[model samples]
Target chain A: MYLKVELNWNVVIPAENLDIKGLMLQKAILVRLLDDFAAKKATKDLGYLVAVTTLNKIGEGKVREHSGDVLFPVSFTCLSFKVFRGEVIEGVVHKILKHGVFMRCGPIENLYLSNQKMSDYQYQFADNPCFLSLKTGSRIEKDVTVRCIVIGVKYMEAQKEFQAVVGLEGDYLGPI
Target chain B: MQNKSGHFDAILLCFRCRHFYNLTRVFFLACDAVPFVLSLCLRKIYSRLRARLKLSFNMSAAGEEEENAADLKIGDEFLKAKCLMNCEVSVILEHKYEQLQQMSEDPMNQVSQVFEKSLQYVKRFSRYKNPDAVRQVRELLSSYQLAEFELCVLGNLCPETVEEAIAMVPSIKSRGRVHDDEAIEKLLNDMSLIKKFE
Candidate 1:
């Protein structure tokens, strides 16, 4: 899911980056803010901070005593993507393993739907490995779009990434 | 005596919150117990516990599919945030990327991996390409006063029938049963109509 989240953070500018003109200083602050926003990536609260849609405010910059760097309190609204359990999501199968298939859903790349989760489908050891459904004879291979419900989600604090365990057990949830 | 009175005020506050929240969806009584037995030290613990309980409340309401992975929750902070459908996100990201390309000499460096992947995902999944169709879809669904999450799910998936819609988002069906099958059917039909015309 994509969310428009308002956030307040302090953006720091080195002494060299500061300009004489007010407009130039403002431009520098925005550039620094965008750079920081991209670098911050995902958070435990908000999944992935994709892009800054709008800059709502740039509060008065305060100079630090020790470093002489200026700190500006920036308030902006950005787009974020987070997936909740039980939410039916569509993903493109990228890699097929005997145990399961790996799919990418928006910013979430590590969505795994295990073979056990897909009870109706049996794995076939073809030249290109795929899961073949017994009932419909539908094949789940690389690049195929599959709809699955998120069964579990884990956020790795070290990597700042989200990995989910998905399932095709529910109704209307299978290869699309 | 002061602490006792404060405890009563907190309970009254919780009841008022429950009353207001009940109007929207099922109200969980889990957090109501926070203020039942309050002491100076216990009150501090209760405040922290209330925050934790509220987080769980939001998660359960979001539709947990299983028992063990109860930790797979998107908290209330995100629930209240404005949710954009895949088509809408595609438009926004595409527009922002284009603007960045025009403004900066090194636009590729400015864009993050998340931004690139999200753009590709949305572009691939977005059902409606036409901007007007997107707007129409939102307008049609908003008439029902569906939660932002539900609205976006319906818009993104564009489920053909009421049954499919419910299957995709069980919360819509379970949340006080505000939407009947007929209403859901009409919503789906209207969504398809927008897509058809587009």
Candidate 2:
């Protein structure tokens, strides 16, 4: 599910980080202060704070001389996502390929609804490269919210990420 | 008449706390000195007292079968916390939900998959009918200052008996049986709905 995650960040200011913050270092500090804060504060309750959409609250900035970094004690709300097996979720169709369609569901948005996951709908490449049901002529394409249940999820060996393989074979889980 | 002693005792508690570590060290040293024979004798005494207390070691053979010790890794602390005790389906679900949210792998990752499957089964059990009781138990456990793991177990297993609690919770032993028992018994008494059910 989509969520707004609020968390605190105390980013270390390396000289390179300041370089990322062009001219007005003070204004750029808040944006850069949140760097890797999500990764640091990832816990069971808070999950992974993947995106910092807004800086809801800000506190007094403290500059450390030794490290040459500014610490911004701020309370910000962002987004968090998680998934469960056999859990059905609705997401917008982000990409359509000849193989399968991807839905940016929950937090990760790497959920791939493969053809094996969709027993009901057959991929019709002649037209929109969408999942077309031979039974009802119903087709699913980009920008459409499709509901699917997670069947298999694998972590990519090379990347620090997860891939969710969802199934639509379950009852009432095609396009909704 | 009460006005004579009415002045709040502004006694410094630091002086008393000064010996806390020394006293704890002494106690541990004393325990370490106890011989195997003495430990066996103590166990005898404990079993006798437990018999008098009518504590239930009634956890079924099924529970033992469910606990496969070799599978759990060190960081899989949650599984160890849950294996020995009974917990509410919803509470366990919530705890696992929180854990799953932070995990890099899928919930079915092999490292703790047995426990995960067990949790999925446990979630189907109907134990969360009373939200009010659940909330009270949650607050009460935090008030008791049980460790995160202990609180998780306590929130799930609303153990009725002193022995059941002692068996299920390691903190009870750590806090000294008498002190923790009294507090936990009071907590269980207050949660009558959970106390009566199972």
Top candidate (lDDT): 1
Per-candidate TM-scores read 0.80, 0.37
lDDT string for model 1 (B85-174, tens) is 999998898889899889889977778999999999999999999988888888888899677888888889989988888888777777
lDDT of 2 by residue, A13-122 (tens): 45545554345555566546444543343344333334444666656757788877766677765544334344444556888986789986534557788876677777
RMSD of each: 17.4, 25.9
Residue B185 shift from truth in candidate 2, angstroms: 41
Could you give candidate 2's per-residue lDDT for residues B79-158 as a string of tens digits? 22222112343454456456666774654552232234334434433234455555556666667755545555445445
Clashes of 1: 0
- Model 1, range A54-168, lDDT digits (tens) per residue? 9999998899999999999999999999887777889999999999999999888899999999999999997999999988999999999999988888899999999999998
Model 2 misplacement above 4 A: A4-8, A13-29, A34-77, A94-99, A106-109, A154-161, B1-198
Worst-scoring 10-residue span by lDDT in model 2 chain A: A40-49
* Candidate 1: clashing pairs of residues: none
DockQ for each candidate?
A: 0.41, 0.03
Worst 10 residues of 1 chain A by lDDT: A80-89
